[model samples]
Target: MDQQGQNGLMRTFREPWRSRGALAYVVAALLTGFYVVLYWTEWLTPAAVALGLRSKWLLYGALYSVAMVGGAAYYLRHHGNSRYNRVRIAVNVGVQVALAFLLPLIMPLFGGPEAYLSYFWPLSYDKLWPSTLSSLPVYLALYFIVGSLLVAPLLAYRYGKRWYCSWVCGCGGLANTFGDPWRHLTASSTRSWRFEKVSVHTVMFVAVLTTFLLVLDAATDGATGTFHWLVAGGQWWSVKQLYGLVVGAILAGVVGVGFYPLFGPRLWCRNFCPMAAMLGLFQKLGRFRIAVKKDMCISCGNCTTYCEMGIDVRSYAQSNQSFTRAACVGCGMCAHVCPRGVLRLENAPREQADKARVRLPVVDL
Candidate 1:
């Protein structure tokens, strides 16, 4: 193994829970069931009360923080030798605990708005909605508007989506930590990539459309009665309700984490996250790329195998292609797992990247 490669055996396929084995399915079922109960029923409310938590969401947040902490320790035990991995995991875990979990939980007690600093539109999905913004304090409303419309895209353009997706977002944090064990299970097939391109962007479009309709409904204020009813009226079948039920509750909460043992950690990030889709557009215009060293790839397959996003990294390595994929969350696993030191993640000027790519000889695949 190269110096940057993983330090010990992952034993991914051999492990029943990590592999798509019977145990994996069982775990998935349990997770799905838990989310179902949490979302639809009050069964966990008593548990929350017993624990002195204000709501089931607070209980869920506490559990989520614990899982990330435990999983981070497990991940560090195997990959902590690398400074990048160590620091990234630590920062990610810290962000989840403090900003995502604790901050929101504590804010309401002091008569402040409950805000998840780590989230923005369209992942939070409602942050930009006119109704939601109107209900918030001016500072928080401005924060969401500026953060989502300007700051998030600017950061993605400068550092790629990694600044948020890898280092700050709770979804990505949980995926990198708790979902680390099943990272190898992400499908790298061309079919999977095709589906991802269509599905993720489709979700993005719907999110934008939904937000637009919501804002318009608020502006009309029931004058466009049917449109208002369809968009955001208090009805079970309203667009807002459906999006919350299907995209937010089912896709993000249930399928995303629940299917992790079977589909890998990035099921949501890769194929369903509207926020990822939006940021990915900025990432394509950004400086981030995985620079592949020329003619040094041994075809060991570790890089592709460990990619949580299902990117076929070995093909790029074999072709000596310094490349950027929109799906890449910049988790650094490809560079970390390459046994021949054939890959590095970097941010550089377009001219420098072009020059470097031109110098590298493309091997026949």
Candidate 2:
């Protein structure tokens, strides 16, 4: 344990991983580029190397597959440290955010006669056109693509979602990495269960409503994508503000969950996340989730204490109910922190005929 022994041990451990980072970049870039080609195949009039009009899931499956196998290989070889998925994280959010603001709508910020401004949203049929609104399927697929292909695995695979939010997500990482001073935003959650109930429910409803109205507006005119760019310098200004709002929400969670780990666990996940609200749907239908057994239960609140989403893990562990709650993020904090090996992660629930079988109390049958 002396400094010299520690130094020798560190040296021994550091050498084998000679810039795994660089190779990860190369691989993610190539894989992303391959998906891009797959995406553009519909427009490739010549039908060159046609993937032949497959199901959307097939394409997503391919993307997810590449990300998984590649991510797993990295996971097995690397420690589950911050360094493991840096490449994938950077490429994932980097490409998405850059395209979000820097594409056609970006106006030069320096030459403005009036105040400088920027745009955050995109244009109609210009870039990710379907984001504005179209068919229900396209509309539904909008955030699904953002979360599933982009966000989910980034959270689920190696390090977890906190890593994704903290490191890779440009907007998320900003408040997380630099806005510590503004940590007060999220810390304001109510301690009273009743108040927490009202506030969290209100926030969730409002977010969903705002999103719905915004989508309805865009879909109605086929112009929502084009609206932000109407004024030349307006978009980037909007982007600055929008990114702040997104970060503010994250701040709420971080302060509620990350900083105040002792007072309680993750406040945002339990109370505020609209995205988690949406993810919970798939989580209900999701092939994967966490599981628990009654015999191993210790009645300790360790899992509940650490949960960012704020479910009472100890309660579920004590009952016959499934652990895969709709709101569960599957962040694995509960699994990692469980001292008695009482909590576990697992798959989706199975469907049954007419009605799912339910056990009832005996009444002298």
Candidate 3:
């Protein structure tokens, strides 16, 4: 093709159906209506009649619906060269539609647990351990253990946190698509990173402490003493009707998501997600790294600008350093937006991560 023809083709690719924005809105409204029909009609009768309150599934259903439908609409409106977003959308819809919605509805027919698994608070390790100490059914314990421990660790070890954070998590799906336009608001400062570490770990500590106290309280149910009193009080504050239901639903879901426009896409994940923190610990030992090709970088700073996790991507690229941060969720926005193709997500051997690489001159390096 001639240079002018190539220029026209590039322009066409960049401008994707701008006049059809209204069509996205129309599709979103129809999808939401379909979700409402599924929920109200109770077509999935077994799931709608699960052990705990079935109304809770309504909330999960709503989140999944919006993330799947609305998130996709948003992406279609801005369609471009990033195949990553397309994959992310597919994974999000599959998780929300099949796993969160349909599976739960049908699982009850097969005698699954009454309570559904939440992305954040599904596993109560306190209830899972010492089977005789608590009245929690074996099936529920197996569910929590399998989801949080067995499945989570194996995936994080291989793919870093991307397996969940960027692909499957409803919270992260909402962030990546619904909160995408505001992702640049994420703070990329040393101070912010330090604060983020402290905040997220603090939440993780609270979750662990609360779970431990719940176990202790259950084990000493009939005992009476100072220790017992302490345990009881801790259980009341941490578990009785608070942390999982209130904090997880209201603070984490509502407020955390609400602040996306103001604080950036990952307000919850970066600052207060115990799940993200736990997964990050596993990710520190992960092999996947966003490797930088230093010679191709132009220092235009697009990568740094779009990093939803607030990573200083340009600095890593400048120094030929791959992202080693435990906080990285492997979203690949930094690579996707790089005009020069200076970054690629790849696995590096943990043992050889310290090995030397071929050097470029100071000017390019």
Candidate 4:
């Protein structure tokens, strides 16, 4: 290539906002907002609650997404957010506890079946439908068996990261969301990078294994366990319910360090994200993935530091394939930062891994 052409290409490569993680922030907000609105407005359900679509997970995803964004926003406001650690914890437990007490009151408003909230019992949640879920052993058999075979498999297949476990139907996102700000304090290894890597890979393994276990258990109609006994007294202060309140000063301090002090409010996304584990599992068998390119590459490693998940996009960026790991959030921060315009997030078929000698610069990474 002519020097003029080379120079022009080099000139096009430099964009600083990519390094600043500007787009990551943008995408996160947009997604958070998208789901928040959907749930808040009931935008998904039709005029037919009798069809049972109202209780589907899209609604739960929206509800949980609101919880996550709330956690991030909360951590961002409280500087070094160790300050808000207890407050955030309180908010989460309080919301759930309140919901427990309130669901009974709230259900009448919805004109739904009246159900009892077990305050301190083994059954965490139970809704007594107007009729039994199934009358016969075979029909009852489907309840347990289909739990794993149908709902679990379909949910896993549809949203790779156990979206139900993380953002969609996630109950833990309430806690994990607050965890972001405290990430650095919980940075266990002297090797921050290593600590981050081990945690994600570990969770990725657990996520896949557990997700499959859930599927298997559901399919087998096995009666797995739940901890509904934690809801003592039907309010926040009962002994069991109180156990949910302890968010640990150490953990809270970790949030303050990671999000409030060090990275943006999602630092724990690196060290302790089981949601990633679930997502990572789904990601492997799933359709979409981040595509990377190496040949036209200049290795100015901006994408690595910007990763809230602590994924080294630079390593992936230097490759010619879609990163098969589940950790990649499909967050396009890497593609947004390429100096040589070598990175991109593509849904190209797996067979098309190397068709582009030089891929276009992704503006929306």
Q: Please tell me which predicted candidate would have the highest TM-score against the true structure.
A: 1
- Highest-lDDT candidate: 1
User: What tens digits encode model 3's per-residue C-alpha lDDT throughout 1-365?
Assistant: 23111112234213222122454345435534544454346555555456343654654575556665786776545543466667777777668666666666767667764344545342233334343224446666676667776788778878888888888777787787777656776878877887889988888887777667656665777265665455444464535345655446544655566556556778888888878888888887777777887577888777777778888888778877666667887888778767778888777675365344433221111
Clashing pairs in 3: 51-114
Q: Compose the digit string of candidate 1's lDDT tens values, residues 1-365.
A: 33545665557688888888899999999999999999999999999999989889889999999999998988887777778888999999999899888898899999998788888999999999998899899999999999999999999999999998999898999999899999998898867887899999999999999999888888888688788888887887899999999999999999999999999999999999999999999988888888889999999889988889988888888887888778999999888878788999999766664545543322222
- Residues 173-268, candidate 2: write the lDDT tens digits: 232222212221222222433444565556545554444444554566635565434321145344323432443423343343233212223344
Quote the positional error of residue 173 for candidate 4 in Å: 9.6
- The deviation in Å at residue 239 for candidate 3 is 5.5
Q: Runs in model 2 with CA error above 4 Å?
A: 1-205, 215-265, 348-365
> Per-residue error at 193 for model 4, in Å?
5.1
Alpha carbon lDDT at 119, candidate 4? 20
Q: Candidates' TM-scores?
A: 0.95, 0.41, 0.74, 0.41
Alpha-carbon deviation at 280 in model 3, angstroms: 1.0
For model 1, state the Cα shift of residue 278 in Å: 0.9
lDDT, candidate 1, equals 0.88
The runs of at least 3 residues in candidate 4 whose Cα sits more than 4 Å from the true structure, single-residue gaps closed, are: 1-108, 111-159, 162-190, 197-260, 339-341, 347-349, 352-365
Collision pairs in model 1: none
lDDT of 4 by residue, 1-365 (tens): 23211212233224332222465345445544554544345555663254443353334433444665676565334322232233434444454434433454456567653232222110111111111223224443455345433554455555444233333322334434544432222222236555666865664454344334434444545443332222223466533333223221122223422233234434434454544444455666665556565476565665554444555566556654445445555434355445565665544345544433343222212
Which order, best to worst by TM-score? Answer: 1, 3, 4, 2
